[model samples]
Target chain A: MTYCVGIKLNAGLVFLSDSRTNAGVDHISTFRKMIVYERPGDRFMVLLTAGNLSIAQSVREILQTEQLKDPGGGEPVSIWNARSMFDATRVLGQAVRHVYERDAEALRHSGVEFNVSMIFGGQIRGEGMRLFSVYSAGNFIEATAETPFFQIGESKYGKPVLDRLVRPETSLDEAAKCALVSMDSTMKSNLSVGPPLDLAVYEVDRFASEKLVCIDMSNPYYRMVHSSWGQKLREAFDSVPDPVWQGATDLPLATESCQHKPLRKIGRPEERLI
Target chain B: MTYCVGIKLNAGLVFLSDSRTNAGVDHISTFRKMIVYERPGDRFMVLLTAGNLSIAQSVREILQTEQLKDPGGGEPVSIWNARSMFDATRVLGQAVRHVYERDAEALRHSGVEFNVSMIFGGQIRGEGMRLFSVYSAGNFIEATAETPFFQIGESKYGKPVLDRLVRPETSLDEAAKCALVSMDSTMKSNLSVGPPLDLAVYEVDRFASEKLVCIDMSNPYYRMVHSSWGQKLREAFDSVPDPVWQGATDLPLATESCQHKPLRKIGRPEERLI
Candidate 1:
């Protein structure tokens, strides 16, 4: 299992991925899941992957060399030389399809789905930053202002925070922090998603970024955030008054005069709520 | 789809369930998932079901009269006559198996799995309160101090808070509050789980409880909690500092200078990370 998130914000883009991988609990291992492609002042891209490691690695390898045919039959389109992020993503889709063509049948015979999903986002020299979630089928969906983020692999546990916190206008650094918090929630509930995170932040239209980091359990800032978030969350919970079953005006959760009845009881076979 | 959670604390037991049921997103309706069986002052039990509504409803119908043979050749043990909470849970499991025996084959023929899970817990006259998670296979597991809660259906989105907040010593009201908060998170992220929730709270050894309520969108207390929790959570998130990439302080999430090279860039099809 894995947990990876990519957010395209007005300020920039934020990418975070956990490093744990396991065929089974006993075989758990750490493998970095974030990859950055940077040409300093020219272009910058980040890829976060989840699903079968072999499939993802193959796609990554092929992605470098994968090409899409040009409509005019001239130079083929590839990620590095693509004029727009849309064309770059098309190249990525082609890479995924290439791997599928090579491995899907064999994997099916072995009872393994050719499962792989990725978040691919970045900027090229001319266009605005774009982020997309690529599916195993080689199709993809781009993020928009109304839905400015994408998450892949074991996504639910980490989703609530993103649902509440992320916005198209959020700062790149804040979105990074939100992603880590989201990852933290996931790590707390799921053993399969562990530490040694890879994170990258890109400023929109900059064509390059320098904010990249690798975080392990020993990282000082993460430790502070983890402990402080927990403590502060507890304080917040404590501040909320407990439900009072019967009350006049004090925020009681349940009152005697409410229209809804308590659940109906059945002590005998003949009893039913309906 | 559904979301139901049962928690056992030193103060008592808490059970909460959402009322949404859907065959697909287009076929959604409200069907209450909680059933309480109490011979007030004698025995008090709450059953929260998730998964196939038909199967669970049948189990509940059969459960009213379902009986387990006594090893000692005494009278058959029905939930109403069970001397221990354990025996009542066993009868509930038996009810599940009965439903499976009757419908599993037919459901499978139509491509539906015999999917159903339940959280059953309460106090029977003579024993301490007990909580259980019953499976589709008619097997069950009891909650203990180390893991004093069980959630069924669409559970992951709401799990992080339970992991962070629940403890053996948590108060009944607090646990109930936590359960509602967890349910709120699930509902926010999943369309399948929705409002008009049923909640029941039991005090240890009481054999009955008065704290039961059906909370709909208009319910004042739930309205307060839904708004307050979301608002407070946002405030907490805002209070946390955003990531600072080039800072001097050693933050746990700070970018580390590493011997490992940055991810390889691809300027053309020939460029590869390796």
Candidate 2:
């Protein structure tokens, strides 16, 4: 299992991935999942992957040189020379499909589905930023304003915070902070997602990023965020008044303002109904 | 889909379940997942089910009359007559197996797995509180001091809060509050789990529980929890400092205190290697 998130906000893009990979609980290993592609003044992109490591590594290997013939009889398109992020992702999708065509049948015979997902996001020199979640079938969906982030692998445990905090108007640093908090929550709940996180922050139209780093357990900012978030969350929870069992008017838990029916307990154990 | 959680604390027990049931996104309906069996002054138990609605409903129906033979050949043990909460749960397991025998094969022919899971917990007059997570195979595991709660169906989104809060010494109301908060989180992230919700709180050695209620979107308490939690969680998140882009020693995101290899960005896009 893995947890990787890619955020596309008005300010820029944020990508974070944990390095833990496991074939089984006992076969755990560390495999960095984020790969950055930068052409200084031209383009900057990040790819975060999860699922079968073999397939993802294959897709990554093939993606750099994978090409799609332009239907208009122009030069073949590859990630390096694609005019737009959309065409670059098409090259990526083709790479995934190539791997699927090669491995899916053999993997199916061994009872493993050809499962892999990748978060691909960044900017080309000519366009605004784009973020996409590429699926197992090599197809993809671009992130929109309403859903400005995409997460792959062990995603749910970390989702509520992102759902509540991330938006098109969020600042780049804040979105990065939210991603780390999300990852921290995931690491706390899931053992398969672990330390030595790869984080990259890209600023809009810069076509380059300098805010890239590897975070181990001891990273000062992460350690601070992890401890403080837990403590402050507890404080936040404590701040909510406990349920007033007697339905007090001021802070009632069971108020008459509720129009729905209240639950009824079965008063008898032997009571049976089909 | 459903979301149900059962918590066992030294103070008592807490059970909360959402009522949404969906065959598919378009086929969603409301079917309460909690059932209570109370022989007041003798025993009080709540069963929360998730997975195939047919299997769970059948298991619930069979549980009413399902009996396990005693090794000594005394009257067959039923939930009502069981000597302990563990024994009652065993009877419940047998009921699940009975349903599997009758339906699993036929269901499998149509490509549906015999999927069902349950959280059963409460107290009998002679014993302390007990909590068990029962599986479709008619097997179960009890919650322990270190891990004092079990969640079924759409569990991941709600798990982080529970992991942070519930402990043996947590008060009954606090556990109930925690359970509600957990459910609120799940609802926020998952469309399949929604209101109305069933909640019951049992005190230690009580053999009965009076704190049972159904909460809907309009319920004052749930409304308060739903709104307050999002606001407070956002406020909690804001309290944390944003990442320092300049690598300031005071609050740096990329401090030299870290002992992990930093990720190296691919400086050239045309470089390709397998």
Candidate 3:
């Protein structure tokens, strides 16, 4: 299992990925999942992957040197030379198809799905910024303004935070903070998603990024977020009013005069459930 | 899809279940997932089911009248007649097996797995309160001091709070509050789990519980929780500091002198990923 998130906000893009991987509980290992491709004055791209590690690794390796035929018989399109993020993502999709053709049949014989998914996003000199979620079938979907983020692998546990906090207009620094908080929530609940995170922040239209960093258990910012978020969350929970089961309050939990029908307990074997 | 949780703390037990049922996105209905069997001063049991609604409803119906034959020709053990919470759970397990026997094959023919799970807990007069997670195979596992809660269906999204807060000594009110917060988190992320929730809280050693209530979107307390939790969570998130990508803070996010090696951006097509 893995957890990786990529957000394309108005100000910038934020990418975060956990480094833990496991074939089973006893065989867990750490493998970083983010790779950056930068042509400082031309383009900057980041790839975050999850799913079968072998499949993902193969796709990533192939993508570095992979290219696609220019349907118009021009030069081959590769991530390094693509004019737009969409073309770069197509090169990635082609790489994934190449890996599928090479490994899918043998993997199927061993009962393994040829599965890998990726979040590929970046800014090319001529365009704004773009982000896509590429699937195992060599298909992809671009993120829209209304949905400015993409998450891959073990996504649900950390999703509520993103759903609530991430927005197209969020600032670069704040989006990075939200992504870390989201990752922290995920790591707390899931053992398979462990430490040693890879994070990169790219300012929109910059055509480059210098905010690539690795974080582990001792990273001060992360440690503070981890401890303080839990403490503050508990304090927030403590502030809520506990239900006064049968009593009156501003909000009656179960007042005798309430309009909605409450569930009636069955007092005998023959009683009907209402 | 569904979300139901049963928690046992020193003070008592808490059970909560969402009432939404959907065959797909287009076909959704409200079918309550909690059933309370209470014979005051004798026994109090709560059954929370998740998975196939039909299977769960069938098992609940069977459990009401289902009986297990006594090996020595004593009276059959039905949930109503069971002497211990454990015995009542066994009756529930037997009911699950009966349903599987009758419908698993037919369900499989339609490509539906015999998918169901449950959390059954309560007390009989002579023993302490017990909580269990029953499986599709009719097997079950009891919650203990180390792990005093069980959640079924769409559980991951809501699990972090329970992991952070619930303990053997947690107050019943706090646990109930925590359960509601957890449910709120699940509903925030998942469309399949929705409102019209059923909640029941039981006091330890009490043979019956009178706190079963149905909560809907209009329920004032739930409305408060929904808005307050979301607002407070956002406030809590804002309380944390944003990442200072390159410049120095007390906790340097990516200072030039940092010890860990940052991810290097590949500047050329021939560059190797390190």
- Which candidate should be chosen as best, given lDDT against the real structure? 2
User: Which sections of candidate 2 miss by over 4 Å?
Assistant: A255-261, A267-270, B269-274
lDDT of each: 0.87, 0.90, 0.88
Cα lDDT of candidate 1 equals 0.87
Q: Write the per-residue lDDT of candidate 3 for residues B115-162, one digit (tens) a residue.
A: 999999999888899999999999999999999999999998898889
* Per-residue lDDT over B1-274 for candidate 1, one digit per residue giving the tens place of the 0 to 100 score: 9999999999999999999999888999989899988897889999999999999889988898899999899999998989998889899999999999999999999999999999999988778899999999989999999999999999999999999999999998889889988999899999999978999999997887778888887777787888999888888888887766665755535555443344444554556566
Query: How do the residues A202-273 of candidate 2 rate in per-residue lDDT, one tens digit apiece?
Result: 999999988898989888888899999999899999998788876435656655555556665565446664
Chain B TM-scores per candidate, in order, are 0.95, 0.97, 0.94
Error of 1 at B163 (Å): 0.8
lDDT of 2 by residue, B213-257 (tens): 878887777778889999999899899998885534576887666
Q: Kindly give the stretch of ten consecutive residues in candidate 2 chain B with the minimal lDDT sum.
A: B265-274
The CAPRI class of candidate 3 is: medium
Candidate 3 C-alpha lDDT tens digits along A1-274: 8999999998989999999999999999988899998888799899999999999999888888999998899999999888889999989999999999999999999999988999999999989999999999989999999889999999988888888888899999889889988899899888999878899999987888778889877777777888898888778788888767655578766654434577878777776664
lDDT of 1 at B194: 91
The better candidate by DockQ, 1 or 3, is 3
Per-candidate interface C-alpha RMSD? 2.4, 2.0, 2.3
